[model samples]
Target: MSISRLHIERVRNIQTAALHQLQPFNVFYGQNGSGKTSLLEAIHILATGRSFRTHIPKNYIQTQQADALIFAQAHQEKMGIQKFATGEQLIKVNGDSIATQGQLARLLPLQLIDPQSTDLIDNGAKPRRQLLDWLMFHVEPDFYHAWQYYARALKQRNTLLKTKRQPTLADLEPWNQMLAEYGELLHSQRLSVLQQWQTFFLHDLQMLLPEIAVQIDYRAGFHPELGLANELQHAHSKDVERRYTEYGPHRADLRFKTALGDADVVLSRGQKKLLVMALKLSQIAMLHASNKETVVLLDDLTAELDSTAQRRLIERLSQLGSQVFLTTLDHVAVQQHLNDLSISYQLFNVDKGQIHAVEPTIYN
Candidate 1:
């Protein structure tokens, strides 16, 4: 699925904006703080109903504004029938509908690769886990609901552990069972997706960065004698001290390794960015393989990437049979790699939160 049009108001620096009739590839060029990233964030909000950049909706509202609004139209072809999807999503502050956005995630799977993507390797485990969870949420229909239940159960279990001190095994047994059941199920689902990706997309990723041998490891309370239940029991004293559950799937993490070394240590700035790009590419390939069309959103596409890696990325993205939205500051950054490419793209020039489409003749 692809977005045919997008309308925005009171979002960030963009007071009112409407972009329609998108091409397969779009390039948004602007100086820093000119609302370029906000455009991408609006698209992401429409797709996931949440801002990938900020947690606070108020931040999305322009300073001193009450709310923000986003509107989008999506197109899809299914069973040889073309269909249009439309919706109105709203975010209200103080009981008023000031801003709104919505998205068709399943029909419109989007892989957003941004400058922050480098953090997937250089930072904590949450981003890496998110990579797995996002894929699982889209591929396995049941995973989302199960994950929701597991999170609620886990929170309740932690609360129980916190309030009640010196609780016996019998008191905690029920929550333990629930945690173990859901935790194991979540782990298995993630492993299944990773295996499929490794089998099909890993090779294509290797082609992007030929030197590194990438590996994904899933560890979810997977130790003998100290399983999920045992770990909980073992950490009982610490849980009481900290007033929270210390371990479980919530504590689980993924480890990425390469033939040269661990991703955390040996990968350079450019290498880490390449690793993340490769992972996103793998996701795009997997989605295409399942016969799902997607829209790719990328911000700061030139950062931390050398010419060779950028070329490889463009090639992989082109082969996925999907529309792509890319934002960058320097036209020269894309000109070297995308020059003479026959793919269709619309160019937009952004200035001070205002955007206008630039004709192809400008490049000529």
Candidate 2:
């Protein structure tokens, strides 16, 4: 959803702020420690109902503040959250109260790239699997329900195995059956989405990081030769010993490699940034194909790019046609390149805790 209006209070350094007349592109520029990044972080909270920068909600509220709030209207739907220091929060979507984060996430489809984005490549497969699941959540309508079932069944199965006394196969039969049913659904959905996206996935990857030949393959955790039921049947005793189901879509990964083979950690920082950006672009393409619009929050997009790389990146973003909000500590250096792209934009200055909208800001 593309948010046309935003209301924020007691979030990070900003005590009160509201933005209207939001445009396709937004640039929040200021010097270091001027609260520029906090503005973007606030937008992120509105979209996903949480901050990508930190997991500690209390860390975000202004000091000496007991609560924080963020609300926005997007695609004619109402969404927002109010967080209290007592470890409680309320979420609203489409003017109705929402309890789970998934409910809020379903209302907003968003992608964020920050300095920590490189972790997508350098970290474990868990993060990579999450990135893929985000696509499945939006691409396939039945994914969420199927996923909930699978997670519940997996939990139940694990609980059976963790008893003080080791449980027998008979004890695990029901949950194993449930897990098998929904696990395969998840696997199938992810595989189909990736297959459909392969052509353009590689195209965007190669275009952005041309020097490296990158490849991504789906690794469904269990052996392909075995059916879910058969695999679970065969591993029953071992899983009982391990106290957990060892194989399923939960352990799946998008294996990334290069021409030289297995380039997970070998890519340079700049190259990794470009590759991550490319992946986000591919996701944007997928959303566009499905007739959905996403708000892209880019933090410090110019950090590692040279002049030419910077231009190419901005041009690529312009072509995507999504609402964008990006921040930078230096504005003058990026102004000319933005002008060359001929994209409409709104520029604002961030200082202390205030956001001042620049007048006549849309320069085409």
Best by TM-score: 2
User: So what's the TM-score on candidate 1?
Assistant: 0.87
Candidate closest to the true structure, highest lDDT: 2
Itemize residue pairs with steric clashes in candidate 1: 46-102, 68-99, 69-100, 89-100, 89-101, 90-100, 91-99
Error at 298, model 2, angstroms = 0.4
**Alpha carbon lDDT at 186, candidate 2:** 87
Report the CA-based lDDT of candidate 2 relative to the real structure.
Answer: 0.81
Name the TM-score of candidate 2. Answer: 0.94
Q: Candidate 1, residues 312-357: lDDT per residue as tens digits?
A: 7776788888788888887565755666566677889989889899
Q: Number of clashes in every candidate structure?
A: 7, 0
Candidate 2, 23-54: lDDT as tens digits:
77788887777787888888777667678778
C-alpha lDDT values of all predictions? 0.73, 0.81
Q: Which regions of candidate 1 deviate over 4 angstroms?
A: 76-104, 221-226, 332-336, 362-364
